[model samples]
Target chain A: MSSSANHAVSYPRFLVRLLSVATDGGLQFYAWMTFLTAIALVGANAWAHQVADGMVLTHMTDHVSWGLYIANFTFGVGLAAGGVMMVIPAYLYDDHAMHDVVIFGEILAIAAIVVCIGFVGVDIGRPDRIWHMIPGVGRFNWPMSMLTWDVLVLNGYLVLNLHIVGYLLYHRFTGRKPNKRWYMPFVMASIVWAISIHTVTAFLYAGLGGRPFWNSALLAPRFLASAFVSGPAFIVLLLLAMRWLSDLKIGAGPIRTLVSILRVTTVVNLFMLASEVFVEFYTGGSHTAAAQYLFFGLEGHNDLVPWMWTSIVFNVVAAGIFLTRKGIEDNRFLVAACVLTFMGVWIEKGMGLIIPGFIPSTLHEIVEYAPSLVEWKVTAGIWALGGLVLTVGVKCGVAVLSGHERLVKG
Target chain B: MSDSADGVSRRTLLKAAGATLGAAAFAQALAPLASWAEGMSSEDFLATHYKELDAEGLKTALKRIEEDTKKKTGVDVHVTADAPIPGVKFGYALNLSICIGCRKCAEACHEENNHDRKTNNSYIRVFEMDKGSIDFAKGTVDYAHPVPQPDKFYMPVQCQQCDNAPCVSVCPVEATWKEADGIVVVDYDWCIGCRYCEAACPYHARRFNWQAPEVPAKEINPDQGYLSNRLRPQGVMEKCHFCLHRTRKGKLPACLEACPTGARVFGNLLDPDSEIRWVLANKRVFVLKEELGTKPSFFYFFDE
Candidate 1:
């Protein structure tokens, strides 16, 4: 054992050291951070412009009131929920190799939630008045509004993950064995909370009976299934990157386990998509107007057709790759599958799902929406910020877990 | 000078330059927020929800709004927070048989509600549909040269003001609610403008203010109800309240008066002898999207 194990530092000292370790990094780290920060600044500048000018800068009319921002927000909720895929295998099944790197999953969840909240903040017309949703001071229409439930679940999931991750990391930093009582319950809660976050998000759209496109019973399950695919796909990419760049010896065990998870989830996602499409097309009605606009063209407005088809193609190809022998053995094929599935799910769950709901609007007006440049910048900025958070967190977390950084003195 | 002294001076110079650059960038980044802040007063930001405000507080809020309106549009608009009349349950009905799709009511609504002139925004959308069809897919709102076109029947849609309003339930903030008078209203100051209500309305009744409404000073309607047709802030939801400012005070709605064919009917639903009740009892009356079970106070009838 290392000599640092004998040093039992106070909680305050542990935090101070954690901050110091997180901030101090190599030249490559600085370069990556600088790139992310620059992009984030660009996004912020774009958002400022959006706010100063009206929402008119966005291509969203009163017809398609929601567009790219809501799309990103939906995808983000799934990504955040996807993070718990690691936690379940690690804690529930007690897979030793998976447990060793579960912190990365939790860290990803944190970053995702930050991205989710950022998208929501920018999406609202008055970010300044967000405080109105506060429970006591501002009226919160809870138990009624699905949005209120969503707010509760997303924040609750964030807190649960934060506690579990914080408690474990702090203990590991101080060279102490983490008590089960401190974090075990929260980990369990987070697993359920993860499911709730995405379900509630799906329900936010689903509950609107007026929008026949989203008022589906299958929406929540589809969200979870797709979430499992994207979540593990993301973690697999992270594991491969870490193995390549760092001296940390992540065995092939975690990657294999994640790939297997992705195998089931990816196919299930495609199956659900097919089922939805079959139901929409075979039983065509006025309600199928939005779906028709999405898949085919309704009234010659086929803006989303290419996007939807591309998403399906990417998802199918990736699913095919995952079922192959080289998907497990060859690192390049593994990376390719992960990238394809990640992007596939992003499109399928993001713009493909959200934009179509509003195309043939409630009154059957065929207004279309495309993201404005300002929206794209803001989205890029939020993602870059997520990237920065993940990088710094993984760096600090790996340093601690690998025994490179520990408490030197009490 | 010593090498250490020279290093200190160079370091200080770089630090000063960095600070200057940061300050300038920060100011530039916040320029939008600064300009946005200029439009909203601190009082407006800290204003209470309409229901939470006491009578005294409401008086102050009305005064503040009047002053804000004067400052923005140079119009001395009279804004009232008219409470619903006792034992009154407002109901609206349209005579579809005689309706010509003249769009005069829509125009009246646009002018009376002080809507943004650029979008020609209004609470009413008159759909010109085939005489035998109610399929919204076949309906068109963009007809250019139209007034009771041949074989086309006009159906005007507005907020149903449902007993179980989807819009009210879906609001994360109780910025909107069903009042005692059965008129669903929105506290314009309290809405965060997330547009959830817009998505929830089946009739496509709710309108979102994309930017500050622009009405020329002389054209601005001086008579306004606080929740009815008063100017709404940019980035909030607004919809028809059955012209409560006029309807509650024993005056007819601007739209009703503007309908040259007497195709519109309005009165208290609770009143046994009211015109709306008479239409409901005698005419073949139905509510739009009845399958949704919104139980709208608004009705449609045909005198076949």
Candidate 2:
């Protein structure tokens, strides 16, 4: 290669060339996808008018006050929490191999927060009134309310993480090395913030006095453990997908290391879950009745029992898959294990977490709630929206970091 | 070039003239309220957590309440500055054994709180459960049909106003707090409406106003309590106040008045001869979710 070609290979000049290439077709694809998603969101907003007329437009009734929107919110939060896997490796473990992947995880976190907030807006009858939550303008301080603290912590963490990551990415794109001094403090904060977001969310339900199943002191720990397992599982799947689509490689060694971490976290998650089950059954208190209903299905409310058992089976299977040599080594098997862990966690957290909480309510009543079709569509639409965000975020992140249009160009 | 320059000059002049007039009009609007503006000192309006308010702050707040009531509703409402209930504070006792599940209490609560007429939001929920089933797992609280279904008994649950209210402890802003009177009150103006209190309450006592409540003016109760019945903004949490406005004035709760069977009992627990104390002393009273250790002021009796 000539001297000029070597100069072009330098990170700054390389990024400039990448930018030139991006403007040709890659930028157009990103813009088009964004515009299309924006249009779809507008359509969703119109449908939301019907939801405002009353959840009557949707299939939600008194029995199922929460449906697709809440489930999507739950899933989105899980995805957001998944950012920690990338953070832990790059920051806590000081693994340079995962550094290139960390920025993408931050982008994913931003996308997940958007989806989570969007789903909440759709779930409520009045999205416009969401501003009442803004402090000072409309009574913003409620220390007594876990929901209030949750709102504070989640939004705070989201902004802090996004700013820190975005700052680093921007500097990289501009060919200037970001101040390394800032990175350490931010990395440490990210670790703590990661745990805070998921724990606060778990407390949102666990703090409820009436719902015995959710009110357990184990809720926060269980949430963290599940988040640790599910988050890394998602990152592995994403890395595999990227490798298949492009020349990007998340190295075999780091992948195995992540799998090992996943194995440990999954074991912890299952142990916490088992401990919860044991306490509920053995103590045999007022909460025992709700526990029995969840595990054994009392009085024909067995719909959740089958799902819960399946979730346990899948979790165990996924754990075993990640633990074995062939399972961690084979990319396809790793992907399969990751997918199973994702679904198992979803079922355990979403269905098993929420439904059983309300089963034996404070008044000691079993309210059977099933999501309707409209609820399902709205939910699918939101998930699609989250995927679109991730796609654009990943594209931008890769373009900035790799200094190559080929990685991001449509 | 000269013609374009002239046109630009004209536009700039017009914009400048418009801006001057707008500023003048704004100033004129402010001039009339300049004297009263001193009373509206921004420093005086600093939002404080519920527990942080001092006696002087409370007095000022009470005065502000009276003024606001007079200004907004055109009613001279008496704003009480009394302390919360003493030791034998107000207690609620319900005879679930005799509650026919008429839903009259729900209706009364809706009216008393000035809830949206269309939604008819109520604080109280009466769960009808099958007889001989102690399992809450089998009970269905969400019923489409009307009251008193055959082979079922009714249990009405609302804000227990517990001694150790979880909702009071979790608020980041201290917007909700328990008064000495044993009533859990929320500062509507200070509440961020994050629905944290709703999630924290074990009894599911808290309700969020997702939209600005729309009660008909005529239907609006003129006798408003600052913490209880004034129109709440959207997104903030509200719950049963034990009809604080009426109860504070030595009146019965609207739900108590509406119950035909006289199943609902409300009285000062301090008074030994009070009906609530009598019920507590004699009846087989039970508090919901006792294991949570909330020390609920509300109790249920079997009437046997």
Against the reference, the lDDT scores of all candidates come to: 0.88, 0.71
- lDDT measured at residue B25 in model 2 versus the true structure, 0 to 100: 49
How would you encode candidate 1's per-residue C-alpha lDDT over A1-410 as one tens digit per residue? 44354434356676776665665555787678668777887888888877767777788888999989899999999999999999898889999999878889999999999999998888888777898999998999999999999898988888888888788877887777888999888988999999999999999999888889999999999999999999999999998899887878899898899999988999999999999999999998898898999889899999999999998999999999999999999988989999999999999899999998888989899988889898898899999989988887888778778877676533
Candidate 2 CAPRI classification by DockQ: incorrect
- How many clashing residue pairs, candidate 2? 24
lDDT of 2 by residue, B32-140 (tens): 3344334334532454443556988767776776676566556665555345545647899999788988888998999888787876788888777778864444455
Candidate 1 has an interface RMSD (Å) of 1.6
Candidate 1's C-alpha runs over 4 A off are A1-9, B1-27
Q: Candidate 1 DockQ score?
A: 0.65
Every candidate's fraction of true contacts kept comes to 0.70, 0.26
Error of 2 at B174 (Å): 6.1
Looking at candidate 2 chain B, the ten consecutive residues that score lowest on lDDT are B36-45
| Best candidate according to lDDT | 1
Each prediction's interface RMSD?
A: 1.6, 10.7
